[model samples]
Target chain A: MKAYAFLKNTPKTTTPRGKTMMLDKGLGLNETEDLLATAGDYLDYAKFGWGTAATMDRELIEKKTAMYREAGVIPYPGGTLLEVALLNGQFSEFLKETQALGFGGVEVSDGSTNISASNRKQVIQQAKDAGLFVISEVGKKDPKLDHKLSIHERLMQIQTDLRNGANYVIIEAREAGKNIGIYDADGNIIENELQELAKGGTDRLIFEAPLKSQQVALIRQFGVGINLGNIASNEVTALETLRRGLRGDTVGQL
Target chain B: MKAYAFLKNTPKTTTPRGKTMMLDKGLGLNETEDLLATAGDYLDYAKFGWGTAATMDRELIEKKTAMYREAGVIPYPGGTLLEVALLNGQFSEFLKETQALGFGGVEVSDGSTNISASNRKQVIQQAKDAGLFVISEVGKKDPKLDHKLSIHERLMQIQTDLRNGANYVIIEAREAGKNIGIYDADGNIIENELQELAKGGTDRLIFEAPLKSQQVALIRQFGVGINLGNIASNEVTALETLRRGLRGDTVGQL
Candidate 1:
């Protein structure tokens, strides 16, 4: 039971809450266990942030992934690690290592690198074949390259990835959540861009709303069930509060 | 031993690293232990931010504080909680409760409320009298009110707090660190304001720098030993890297 439960008697909801993908950036064994113990119920997926998994001990990553799996959250290596593997022509080794390390999922993103369209589909299919949950990301790491992609092009990629068996196509906001994908430079949602992207529907799309305002905006826009990704580990509990209208921002509004 | 120790063979520094004060906004017992285990050596103070202490179970807070103390870091409730206590005429009770909860320090400030200079000094002396390490803050929480404070006035307050038995005085930048105290709207440090405030010297002052840019700028300006506060809990390791020139931003510079 939550402390101060009497203050707000939130009605039980039949509608399921949106999936929350938390960004795990270099958390030690103790930190990972603590996160699982505290806010594990609130998270659905945990992404070991860009190239961070490669920096730690194989044993540590395995233990962390086991902890997350035990908590009912899917654990995945960041796409940048995969991108790095592809660049080195070691994608097969990367997949074997990911499985050996006990990761339940993998993120396929060309954020920092490039892959031909045909290759992107093959990669997604390969991950799926390995019995791993595949989440393909759309958008570039660099804002300059990201801006060059038209709305039509983005929609086409989203459609292609979904058809290619990507579980969820993430609209990349790159942690900072600014000047990338559907967000403007100030980190605010460009409504038209967001709407255009959502035309294909939001169920299979996870918006990387790392900032609080973006989380609130997306939650408000899509009701309580909008998938949000790249959330800081500390903000997990707070995000759950926002979704349930326990926070002031969505208290009466939600 | 650190991972990737061979990439950068950092020289042993006889110079003491800066005192880092981390902000704790409602971390659980497990999470607290994780923080201590992962980055406790990098932190000198763990501030339970802004009335968050009041929101948790007494047992939980006690355990958290004990963990911090065992880790050799001073744990304190945020000044806003003390301010709230002062508002409620519960200073003595607050002090008793703080000690009972095992907090090693207390922050004295009128950020969200008003306290006369004499009363503020009395509060600091009272906490010191109770055998608590006292850190007095020197600015308002509101940006407008904070801006109204002249650099001279801030210096006077710092001197007064130090004289009144404050072990350290913090220049308030709040959590956001933008448009408050010496920072401009863009969160960039205003050189003139900072220089004026540091006229008497900076050995005894803790600047609340939450942003990476602010941390880098302050470290660059004042060397590695300048005291900084209000750092997000997760960034403790990252900040230590910056201080030691392990990160790209300060690799060669530091």
Candidate 2:
């Protein structure tokens, strides 16, 4: 049973919350299970952030992936890892290792590298073909370069990725959620850009809102159902509190 | 064995790191064990942030505290809880409960409330006499009030807390680590204020550095052994990277 179950006024999110897609930077096996036991019910996808997956012991990564799968959350390597694989001509090998490790999904992103437009589409299709749910990201990792991409360009890329077989498209905020994608330098959301990006419904889009203020702002703007990503693993329960109007920040407002 | 043991050039700290004082806002038994398994060797203290301990079930808190204690980490309730207890005249009860729950330390602070000088000193001595390591914090949690506290006042409080038998005095940066303490609005360190605070050696002072830049800055300035506090549970290993010169920011610098 949920803690404080008697608080019936806590908004029941009939729609599964895309409210939490926690970033599993480098959690060990015990940490993975701990996360499952603590906030598994609140999470949807767990992304092993950046190129970290390529750095850890393969066996440990496999165990962590299996744990996430067993807990019913989609487990995926970060897009940066995929980008690294692509850069090294190891995309196919990476996909095989991904499946061997028990990951349910694969992210296709060029956040820290570059891939041709045709290759990006082909990679997404190949990943889908490999039976992994694809979560493609649209933004450069570097703030200056990320800002250089126009809203129209990003929107087009999102549409293209979806058409090419991405289950969800992530707006890249890297892990810090600042000066990239929809967030400004102070990590605050750029309202106009966010509104433009949300021209399409946000049901399949995950905005990486790692900062608490960013999380609060997005939750307020799009209600609790907002698909938020790059949340630190520990913040999962805290984010749930905001969605259910349990925390002080959203209690009266929500 | 360390994960990247082959990365032999990673600067090993000859000095003990104060990187262990992590903020546990709300963690259960499993999460506690997971943290120990992943980073226990590095941690010296596990603090349940704010009055969160007062809000959780005593049994659950007991289990969590026992886990931390068994792992050799001194577990303690946040100073705000002690402050609340002092406000309600439940200081003795609070101390009893803390011991009952297996906490190895007690934090006494006037962060959220005023305690007369005598009361503050007495509280610190009482907590110490009760056989708990006393770690006192000095700062207002509110930004405006925090700004009013001149550097001299904070330095004096640190000295008083230490003289009253505090095992270590934590510079109050709260969990956000910005605008309220040695950091500016952007969370960057204000070097002059930090230098003034650290005029007393950092060995007895745990600077609450919750931001990556702050961690890197302090680690660079004070070497790897500098005591830090309010570190998020997940970032312990990441902070270790900076200390050991493993990550990009501190790779060559440290």
Candidate 3:
């Protein structure tokens, strides 16, 4: 049972959503266990944030992945790791090593590197064939490069990724979540951009809303069922409160 | 030993000349372990942030406090808890319970509730008499009320609290660190106001800087020796990096 059982207010989901993806950036094994113990029920996916998994001991990574899986949360190496593997032309070795480390999913992203449309589709298909939940991200790591991606291009990419067998297409905002994709410089939503993106429906799309304001806005705009990614581990309870209209900002407004 | 020990940096005071207090708001045991393992050497005090200690099990609080104390970090309940105790006229019980719970220190403040100057000093003295380190806080919790505190009033409070045998006086910014005390709406330091407050000298004061930008700016303005409080558990390592000029933002500049 949840510690705050009496405080639970059921969230209104527009669809059957299965997960909350937490971005874990450099959390030690002990910290990971605490996170799992506290908010594990609320989480479905744990993404070891960009290149961080590579920096930790392989044994540590295996241990952490096992803990998450044991708690029923699918563990995955971030897309940045995949980009690095592809850069070295070692995608097969990357997939094998990820499996060896007990990761259950693969994130296919071109945020930091260029991958042609055909190659992107192939990568998604390969991950799916390898029995991995393929999550593809759309947007550039560089703000200037991301800005050059027109709404038309983003829409096409999302559609392409979904068609290529991606379980979820994440609109990239990076960790900072500002001046990228649908968010503006202050991490506020650009209404027109969000509108265009949601036209395809948000069922298979996860918007990376890292800031509280952004989470509030997204929850308000799309209701509680809207999938959000890149949520910090500590903010899990606060985000759930926002979804359930428990926080002051979303109290009666939701 | 610390990573990158070869780097020449400003030597952190051997005795921690001024206290560095960290806010611990609902950190699980594993998270606490990670925090202590990483930056425990740099920290002098750990605060269980605002009514959070009351929410957790007494045993849990004891365990956490013990961990901190073992690491040479004085652990205490936040001032809001003391304010709660004062509101209920259980000041004596508060001190007794805090000691029993393994807390090595107590914070005295009227942040969430109003306390007369005599009462505030009495609380500080009582905590001291109980063999606990006493840290008093100045400023209201509400931003509007906090903004009404003039530099002269703030300076006077700090002076008075110091005179009353308070170990250190903290300038309140709450957890958000925006539109309170010396920070503006965007969490930026208000230069003129900060300059006026610096007349108190950075020695006996701790600024609750919860934001990275605030940490960076404060470190730059007051040097790395400036006492900062309310640092997030995960950011403990990041803060040490900033202080040592290891991070990109402060590397060459500091």
Candidate 4:
């Protein structure tokens, strides 16, 4: 039973929608348990944020993945780790290691480094072949590189990634969620850009709306079923309130 | 046993100065473990933020307090809970419950309520009588009410609280750290206001710096050992990095 059961309201969309992807940036075993305990029901994917998974002990990573899995949340390494592995010509090793670490999913992206289209597709397909739910990210870690990729390019990549066997494609906003991809420098959404990119059916896309403003805007624009990513662990419960229209911003609107 | 042991340099003005009172806003056991594991050495106090302590299970609170105690960190409930108890006229019961909950400290504040100076002193004395580390907070929860408190009034309260056996005095910057007390609407510190209020020895004053920019500014102005409060649980490691000049912003400047 929820603590605030009386405040619970039926969500707008009933279909399996609006998956939340939490950004785990170097959380220890205890923190992971806390996260899973509090907001695990609302979370779908837990990404050990950019290159942090590689920095921690393999045993600790496995423990976290197990906890997340037990909570019914798919755990995956950040896309930057995949980029690093690919850059080092260790994509196969990366896949094997991720599996061994008890991760149920893999995030393939060219956010931090460049990867050819053929290789990107292969990575997505290969992860799927390994029985892992594949999530590919679009947008660059560098704002300069990200801004250069037009909305059409973003949509095309999303379409291609989904076509190539990615279960879901994440719109990369990095951890900061500012001045990259759909969000502006102040972390506000650029409506026209978002509309263009989101044309690739929103069902297959998880927008990385890390900031409160971004989350609010995305929830407001797309309603409760807008999948959000890169949410800080602490903000999980607060985000759920927004999604469920429990918060002041979405209370009446949703 | 730090990651970059070779790069470690002795910080300037290191005399075991100033307390670091972190805000533990509803952290679960797992999250608390991660926080202590990563940044336990730097933390002196851990405050369960707002009325979050009252909202959590007693066992969980005890367990969390134990974890902080083991890490040599003093665990306390937030002033909001104190305010709630005071409002209900259960001040004595509140102190008893806090002590029974394994908390080492109590924050006496009229943040959300108006308490007379005599009653405020009694609250401070009562906590002190209970053998608890008494830390009184000076400011209002409402931004408008908080703004009305002149720097002179704030300074007077700090002195009074200290004279009445309050161990430390915390300046208010609610969880958001914006448009309250010393901070502007954008969360930036108003320099002239800060200068006036900080005439009280910075050692006994805990500035609630929830944002990185605020933390950075406070650390820069007051040096590394300034007592900072309301730091987010996850940002504990990041704040320590800033204090130690490990992060890019403060790296050579500090």
Candidate 5:
């Protein structure tokens, strides 16, 4: 059903297509329906993005979640909301509210707050036990704090999150995709860091690639099957084009 | 009817609220409606960026333009598309096609092509004669070429375009809003250049400010009555909040 179906390039490898996690900063119901109509099949998860869900009415959030669910895309609140709830000693309430809001998943991240390793593990298990898909993020929102954590530490956290029952582990690049996790200050990927992180295989890893350059680099490096996250809602179709080698960046190269 | 109307700040000056021109690269019908529903009152123009209008079906573009017009916002094709049409010697056809497509306006820009000042004046006049709203842009798309244009030259061009019947003259910053016109490489405004440009008065100028920082700074400097263009579709409501002192950036200051 693609517009230019005849121009789609065959995959260079037999690797299956990867999951795409879109960042929904704030979208109305009509906008959500529009997204699904155009690029629903290409998306796997929709993250409400860093406390943005809290800014809207609960009914609107529920409607958005239901829409995503109807389209088979798991909808989840941002990890920062969970962190805020945890700070207020309302983690259990947050989980309950997340379910009531029709969210099918929960992102457990310590990006903005300090959570002990044991607590982080428990948080992942709790969300999983609550019949929600758990995606744990590894890295800090603060650049200075992020720099303090070595590659070895990030890899170990990824391992721990997977063992603790997270469905996928996401590298933290935030929305801007610059100077965080595997990306440099200019938003370019650090090849050595990316290589080290991919040592444990990439099937369960979602690299938060918001920029087109990052998406192209990651797709080229890990084949089209590399899970990518933090994509802008409008760029969903464009990303699918890159994945399918329909875009100039990956045309004939994939 | 604003969500948090009680918390709105009073304007510091009696200047009327400025116009906002959102950049619609390629939005579907549902997305367009959602935009109108949430931020219709805040918008004055909707630009189908670059030649993206050429990429989609004619019907879809017509539907989008109709929707925008119904919401009281003028819909126009990007200036680059006009430049493309001029290169193909399809200027008249382009104007005819634009009207058939339901676009209320046309942008005449030399951002991506070279058109002599006289020809540029003709282009503007032709669009005006066609009963279309004309918005002329002043700046080259290539950063190097943009940098070569002196502020005095830019001012002269603005004067010429206004004289030629342009309803408004946009100081081009392109979509990225970086290293062009009055903005520096980091997307920061060169205060002196902006000051120089504003000497001819800013009432007829539309500054293409895509970044939030730029929007905040301009609102701060120009008392929320500075016409801004090239805003991202999703940021329309957020920009309105900034303009009305609802956002933190201009809350107390405005």
Candidate 6:
């Protein structure tokens, strides 16, 4: 039970209504242990954010993945890692090594690199065959390239990924959550674009809401059941409070 | 030893030249434990940001304070917390509670409230008398109020705080570090104002550099020995990387 359980004006008292995917950019083992002790129960998946996994020692990454697994949270490297691996034509080695390191999931994204539709499907299937949960991402890292992808195209990719045995599809907003995907330059959601994106049900869709405003906005739009991704590890409890209406933002509103 | 010690080509290999004061904006005990374990050696102080310390259970705050103390990091509430305590005429009680909780330091400031200069001096003296390291901050939380204060006024305040027994003075940028204090709207440093502020010397001043660019710029200007405050806990290692030239921004430049 929470310390101030009696004073908590929470809507979702026992369980969170939506899934929260936390981003672990480069957390150390002890730091990950602390995160698990504090906010582990509230998190569903942990993504070692973009290319950062490659920067740490392989043993360190292995320890972190084990910690996350023990906490019952799926751990996966950022899609950029797979993109880099694919770039080097070492996709098989990358998949084997990631599993060896104890990761439970794999993210296939073309955020920084280009991949043909067939190869994307093949990679998703390959990851599933390698005994990992597959999450495919939609959108590019570069704003210019992202803007060129129409709402219909993004929607199609989401549908295709879901059909290709991906457990979930992520709408990529990168870490900044601005000027890419469904958000504007000021980090505000593009209403019509989001409406189109939501055409494919929000169940398998995880909107990368790194910013608090984005989290609040998405929660308000889709109710408390909306899946939010790219959440900073430190903000997990704060975000959970927002979802349960224990925080000021959604207190009386929810 | 650093995990990727082999790949790290860092300058200032032996020691970090400056002090780093991290902002703990409502971290629980477990989170504090993780923070200390991950980046304790790199940290000089841990600040419970704003009025967050007053919001948590007294026992929880005590535990966090003890944790920080054990790690050799001085723990103090944010200046606004003192401002709030002073507002309610509970300054003495606040100081006693903070001491009993095992906080090694106290931050005296009028970031959110107005305190007469004489009273400010008295409070600094009062805190020092209680055997707490006093670090006073100079900057209004309100951007407009902060902008109205001239560079000369800020310098005078810093000198006053130092003379009143403050161990060090902080140039307030708040958490945002933009459009207030010595930073421009785009978070760029106002070089002339910063140079003027440094007239009193940089050794006794801590710049609230929450932004990476601000950290890099300050390090470039003052070398690696410039004191920085309001560093996010997770970014402690990342900031250390920047300080030692392990990060791209300061790698070759430092």
Report the number of the highest-lDDT candidate: 5
Better of 2 and 6 by DockQ: 2
In CAPRI terms, where does candidate 3 land?
Answer: incorrect
- On the 0 to 100 scale, the lDDT of residue B210 in model 4 is 95
C-alpha lDDT (0 to 100) for residue B239 of candidate 6: 75
Candidate 2 matches the true fold with a TM-score of 0.63
Model 4 docking category: incorrect
Candidate 3 local lDDT, A153-193, one digit each (tens): 99999998999899999999999999999988988899999
**Each candidate: what lDDT?**
0.86, 0.83, 0.82, 0.83, 0.87, 0.85
lDDT tens digits by residue: candidate 5, A208-230: 99999999999998889999999
Model 2's lDDT to the true fold?
0.83
How well is each residue in B1-254 modelled by candidate 3, as lDDT tens digits?
65666766633524233346787766888878878888888788888776555544576777888999999999998776676567667778778788988999888887767889888888888888889998899888768778888999999999999999999889888788998999999999999989999975889899999999999999887777889998887777788878877788788675
What is the alpha-carbon interface RMSD for each candidate? 5.8, 5.5, 6.6, 6.6, 6.7, 5.8
Error of 5 at B146 (Å): 4.9
**Candidate 6: DockQ?**
0.08
Tell me the deviation in Å of residue B125 in model 6.
Answer: 4.5
Question: How much is the lDDT of residue A242 in candidate 2?
Answer: 88
lDDT of 2 at A40: 96
Task: Count steric clashes of candidate 3.
Answer: 0
Instruction: Please report the candidate that would top TM-score against the real structure.
Output: 3
lDDT (Cα, tens digit) per residue for candidate 6, span B1-254: 43333332345565556999999988876667656655677889999888788788878888888888888999998888888889999999989988987888889988888999999999999999999999999999899999999998998999888988999999999888999999999999999999899987899999999998899899877888889999987788667756765443454456
Residue A240 of model 1 has an lDDT of 89
Scored on chain A only, each candidate's TM-score is: 0.96, 0.97, 0.95, 0.96, 0.97, 0.96
Residue-wise C-alpha lDDT for candidate 2, range B1-254, written one tens digit per residue: 33223333344635565545999989766667667766676688999998898788989988888788887899999998899889999999999989998899988888899999999999999999999999998899999989999999998998998988999988899888889889999899998999998887888998899998899899899988888888898777667766765443454455
Candidate 5: give the clashing pairs. none
Summing lDDT over every window of 10 consecutive residues in candidate 3 chain B, give the lowest-scoring window.
B10-19
Error of 3 at B122 (Å): 16
TM-score of chain B of each: 0.96, 0.96, 0.95, 0.96, 0.97, 0.95
Better model by TM-score, 3 or 6? Answer: 3
Kindly report the fnat of each predicted structure, to 2 decimals. Answer: 0.12, 0.10, 0.12, 0.16, 0.09, 0.07
Q: Which stretches of candidate 6 lie over 4 Å from their true place?
A: A1-22, A26-45, A50-63, A70-172, A180-184, A188-254, B10-17, B51-58, B81-97, B113-126, B176-179, B184-192, B199-201, B211-225, B232-254
